[model samples]
Every structure is written in structure tokens, then in C-alpha cells.
Target: MEMSIKSDAVPASDKGFYKLSWTQRIGFGSGDLAQNLIYQTISMYLLFFYTNVYGLDPGVAAIMFLIVRIVDVIWDPLVGTFVDKHDPKLGKYRAYLILGGVPLTGFAILCFWNGFSGSLLYAYITYVGLSMCYTLVNVPYGALNASLTRDTNEITILTSVRMFMANVGGLAVGMGLPIVVKLFDPSETSDLSSSDSAWFITMTIYGLVGLALLIFCFTQCRERVVMDKSETENVKVSDLWLEFVRNKPLRILAFFFITAFAMMAIGNSAGAYYINYNLSGTAGELSIFMGLGSIPAFIFMPMIPAIKRKVGKKGMFYIFLITAIIGMAMLYVISMVDSLKEHMMLVYIAQFVKSTGVIVATGYMWALVPEVISYGEYTHGRRISGIVNALTGIFYKAGMALGGVVPGLVLAFVDFNKDAAQQTPFAQQGILWLVAVIPAILLLLAMFIISKYDLDDERIDQINKEIEMKHNNQ
Candidate 1:
């Protein structure tokens, strides 16, 4: 379906907002879906694979995770600046989808390969390579969102569709991966541990599929909103921080990204452990539990526009953030009580509630990035989409770093034993903290940070309009 607002006097760009066809929206969304298939798999299961299949120490893996993100802190902004400073012949933002996607796919597959099993150097090389390649795709893709159109409603719908498809990728990873790995290596039925060949084959399949999706996204996206070549002539890495310093809403949103992604990272990374150790679940059950984290997205994401309309953005945030905390509390409580823990239905219900909140709240935050980008353009007269996205990417990776580091550190602290049939009660308790207590605490902090966001819809619309009018006059 295509949506159009006809006005004889105005150019499409002069209108300050453009509506996308369904194909464009879905095509762009496929990029995210692809990333989730590749990266989300890493986020959720790589640590588990490292410890169980690849023989890396939990504490050592945690430090490697930290160092990888530190490298991102330096690399992301350079990618951003380079993107903003030049327009490629292929396409400004969309070009990187293929350029980066190819290497990203290769590195993702390599991350799971246990050829150098237990080799920390190989782990660091593959993991760091994958992380850098990811930023190469991620930063520009974020810029692509802002460049698509300035229409607030369009961006909202785009985000919804993007997240919906992303969860599709998440679901594939969560539900299908374990089952597929087991299909390949049925002899080792207990869990993913020591199933090295299965992990490699699974990642190879996902990586190729992800690369294909990136190609489809590249063909469909056409950058319509962007800074003029003259305006972007002097784009610099330092501008990312300068924008952060000046753009209050960006700062707030940046912090919110940190908390929200961290909350998700910690929970997602711990989910396999939570199910396998704490619940004494089977591989199938582990798939179901991890899959539930994304399942709510299919049900609740389409309602985001309505929810935001009725409650307003911040109101919606407050409602869902609190709901997530409640669900986490239920999870924590259930695991502590034997009777409650015995009923899988109750655990599934708690996961649904918690995921419903987390999915909707975090899914909608992507829309706000465009708003902040517009705010920067209004004030600075330069729509530095790449720089803004780089800034957000840095913080988002920081959250992911915490996700990667915290689980390993906590597992190390609790004396997690890969060879043991079952984890100690203390280790079980720590896993529970990763799944529930820690994420809930972060959601509370996210609520506080998001409350600081001052650019409501009305204000952002006006800013976009003024910026467009200025462009038209020039």
C-alpha cells in the first residue's frame, strides 16, 4: 500500500515528510531482520557457545567482550564521519548494506567456528572482526532510517515494521537454532555444549541468509532526506560528541539506548542459562523460553501507533517499563518457589508479560532517534544523520558490552562449571539475577532517563517543517 498527500504547490521534499510504500518499508526493515538473525544470535548465545563449545573461561570472555566494545567506541564515529562526509556512487546510506554485509556475514560465521577451539586469540579476532563489521552496517542503516522520510507517522510505522521483522529473525534464532543444531548432531542430546560442528553449520546458514536480506534492502532504499554536499563538506568525528553536547534530547535518548539495550542484553544473554540450568529444561524448552522473548513483538508491535496515540510516548514508556518490572518480579518470585517453578505455564506467562513490555518500549525508541536528528538539523542546519546514529551506536554497543561482560563476570563469580551436570544454587541465583532483577533495575533507570526527553511530537514536527522550509528557500 502506498500513502500520498497531494499538494500541487509543494515538491515532495519541500513537504517535510514523505510516506513510504509498503515495499520500501518492508525492504528497509529486512536489514534489521537480517542483523538480528546474525548479531542477535551472537548476543544471545555466543557466550554460552564460548564457554560450553569453545572452552573459553567465562571471566576471560567477559574481558574480551569489554575490549571489543572499547574498540567500537573508537571505530563507530569514524564510520559515521566517513559516511556523512561522502556520498557513494552506489547510494549514500544504503551502499554499506552490501559492502559491510558481505564481510559481516563471513565474520559472523567465523565467530561460531571452533577450529581454534579454546584459543583466546582466535576468539578475539573473530569476535572483534564481527563487531567492527557490524558497525560498518549498523551505523549507516541507522542513518538510512532518518534519511527515508521526515514524516513522524511514517517513521513510527517503519520502526514497528522493522522491529516486527527483527523479532522474526530473533524468533528464528531462539526457536529454530537449537532444534537445527540438534538435528545435525542428535547424538549429543543434552544441550549445545561440545556441539561445535552444529554451531558452525547453523551460523553459516544464517549468515548467507542475512547477506541476501541486506542485498534486498539495498535495492529498495533510496535516500530522500539528507544534508547537501556543501553542508556535509567538513563532517568530522568530533562532531558526534559536539552534537551530543548540544543536543539535549540526543543525550537523553543516547542514555536511554544504553539502559534499554543493556537491560535486553543482560536478559537475552542470560536466557539460555536461565532455562538450561535454573529450570532444568530440555533443548526444546530452552528454544521455547528464548523464543518467548521475541514472540510478544509479533502480537504487540502493530498496536504501537495506537498505544502511543492514546498514552503519548512518555506515558507509553512509563506503562510498559513498569509492566516489564512486574513481569521480572514474577519471574524472580517463581524461580525461588518450588511449586511455582514446577509449572512451565506460569513461567511462560511471566515471560510473555515481561517481553510484551520490553519489546514495545525498546521497539518504539528507534522512532525517537529521527526526532533527535531533526532537532539537531533544526539547530545546527546540518542533518548529520550518520554522526547522530554513530553517537547512538556507541551507546547501544556500550549496553551490549554490559550484556556480554555482565553474564560472564557473574557466571565466573558464581563459579559456573561447564562440565557439571547441574549448576550450584548460588550460580542458579546469579542467573536469575541476570534474567530478572538486573533488567528490572535498568528499566527503572530507563524510565527516569526517557522522562528527560523534551521533544514531544508537536515540537519535532515544527522543527522538521522549519528545516524543510529553510531548504526550500535555499
Candidate 2:
């Protein structure tokens, strides 16, 4: 069975799988880079900021994270449906880069503010607003990937570029942020918890840079494969669920998103605690350790297209997922050994291995999104990219919610004392589990979820061609 639709005028260049120039590719990729700057800071540091620096209770922060994500569940589809149904002068997807980004930057900086320190109301207002604004930009930016072109190979390259740029942002936040905070500390203290002003300054810089990159992205990306205005008028919030129910590949990708992001979120949120308490490492060592997590993306992301071609998607996922699990196990074992516990080099090596596997496997999953979007267009006669991305966003945020909840719960369970200079032995062990075992388990589950994704490159190419043919006929 197939769905059909009458088409409005689509350009000759847009009637078939179009090729994007390097400039266009980089421009589009920058949006992810921009988002990573704002969002990764939150993901990696927000909980620590809340409890250690801003002085919120771990349990309270956990509840806040869950609440924020629940709000996203309601908000994502509305933004998705609205973006699909409305055509703005700036561009369908590109417009949001500025429309949503400017405010996103403001709220992102505010999330780190110490003005109303320990105020739950302040945290809720700032974090919730930041998240909604992020959805406004992110759902559209994801849809923009599918709007670019239909060539499977091109999409692979584009996804690689995007992930590479994203990791660059991760590096800045992961490695550079602690150093930046130290530089800004008035007391010459390396500890971020000692100075709220430093956190605010660091985020302000990151947020402003992100805003500039978003503007650049808006200027560069052109929406090529969008639903015509008339056709879009029929779009409804219900289509988000409708597409999910009928789209098999979307289902597989959505589940994979949940597990994959959960792994990253858990590991990232636990990193500071792992370094500060479990490893007894200094802030500099923690920066280096976290920095290593993103560094491997540079080495591995560029090779993704060639690797995928050689190994096949499922094979690539299997190899990398297993590699990540092995790395996680190494981390757990090394932490337990007194001799290895003294060796920061060993920890860096383990982190490099684990991050390599996790980064490449998860990074390449984004390329699959366009394939699933094409599948939906083929089966449903509508290219509702925004709706599809919104569905994926919900699952990803759910995974993020788990990331936020698990670490906080673990800390609370172990009686982690924010005021203590050193964590209790049991608390240290809980941090170890958060950083290693928990994330490793999530990675294993992610492998199983991705194995269910059946859309190979060849099949997707065939679907794209068929969809293009239908558009050309109309």
C-alpha cells in the first residue's frame, strides 16, 4: 500500500536527489555545533552546577530534570506541527535558527546564573524556558537535515561533518569550561562550586558564541525538499503520533535514540562526580578526562562514511557498541585496583577507548534519521520531517531525563554530602557505577535497539528515488 498526493511547483533541482556544496554542508553542520555549545554545557554540567555550585539538593534537581522533560513531551509535537504547517519568510527550518536561537542563548546563560541561588522557582523557570526554546530550534534543525537532499551518501557525509563540528563544541565545553571557570574565579580557586560568578561568565561566553554560529547556519542552509504551503496547511499535531505508529524505521531509530542518549547523558552527568570523588582527581585532571571523551570524535567521525560502507551499519554498530562496553568495563576494573587508581594515564586511555566507540556509534545514528524521514515520505505521501524529528526528540529527552534522574538518585541513595571535601566510600562507588556500569548497560541495550533498524543505504536510496519520481510526476 502507498499514499499519494498532488504536488505544487517544486524546482527541477529539487525534483530529484540534490547534491549540496561544501559551503552548504558546513553551514548546516554549524547549527549542530551551535546547539552543542549551549546544550552540552547543560547536559554535562547543569546537575553539578545545581547541587555543588548553586546549592540545590540532588533529589530536588532530579525531580526538576524529570519535570522539564515531561514538559518537552507536550511541547515538542506542538512546535513540530507548527513548523511544518507554517512557512516563514526566512525559510521553513532555517528561520528557527534565529527566531528560537536568540532567546535560547539568553535562557541558556540564565540557567547558570547565581543571582537567585537555590531558588527552585528560578531553576524551573530558566531551565524550562531554555528547553522549550531549544525544542523550537532543534526540531526544526533536525528537519532541515532531511530537507537538504535525498542522496544517502551525501547525507552520510553531512552527518559526519555535523557530528565532527558538534564534538568541537563538546571539547570546548568539556575541556575548556573548567579552565575558563578557574580563570574567572576571584579567589584563584579552581573549584567551580566556590564561585557562581565564574559559571555565569563561562556560560555567557559560550552562549554568545552559539548565537553567532546559529545566525551563520541560518544564512547558509536553504530548504529544498519542503512540503508546499498548501499541503502543509493540513498538518496537525496528531500527525506526530500518526507518523510514529506507521513508520517502522522511525520506531527503531526512536528507541535507539532513547538508549543511546541515555548512555551519553548518564556518563556525562556522572563525569564530574567520578573525577572529583571516585578518582580523587583534581579539576585539571577532570577537564582532561572529560576532554578525552570528545577528542576521539575528531579521529573517528571523519572515518564514519568509509567505515559504514565497509562494515555495513549494523556491523559498525556491533563493533563500536562492544568496544564502548569494553572501555566501560576497563574503567570499572581500573577504579577498583589501588595501583591503577593512582594512574591518571590509564583512566585517560580507557576514556578515549570508550568515547571512541560511543561517539562514532551514536554520531552515525543521526544519518539514519534522514533515511527514516524518506521512508515516511514514501509510505505516507507526506514529508513531515519536523514531526518525525519531534518524535525522536521526545525519546532523546526521555533518555536525558534518565541521565539526570539516575545520577541524582544514586547520590541521594549513597548519602552524598555536598559540603564534604571527600565523598563516603559507598558514595564514591555509586559514582563509579554511574560513570561505567550503568552507561555500559545502556550501550548494550542500544546495540539491540539499533539492530532492529532495517533501513540499509540501498533500500533508502530506492525509496528516495521513488519519492522523487512521484514529486516529478505531480
Highest TM-score against the true fold, candidate: 1
Compute the lDDT for candidate 2: 0.90
Q: List ranges where model 2 is wrong by over 4 Å.
A: 1-14
**Candidate 2 clashing pairs?**
none
| Candidate 2 residue-wise lDDT, 1-474, digit = tens | 123222454543555567889998899889999999988898899999999888899999999999999999999999999999998889999999999999999999999999998899999999999999999999999999999888788899999999999999999989989888888888885454458898999999999999999999998997888888888889999998899999988999999999998889999999988888787677799899989989999899999988998999999999999999999999999999989989999999999999999999999999988888889889978888999999999999999999999899989999999888788889989999999999998987888888888888878877887787777677
Q: Kindly give the number of clashing pairs for every candidate.
A: 0, 0
Candidate 1 lDDT tens digits, 346-381? 999999899999999999999999999999988988
Candidate 2: how large is its RMSD? 3.1
Global lDDT of each model? 0.91, 0.90
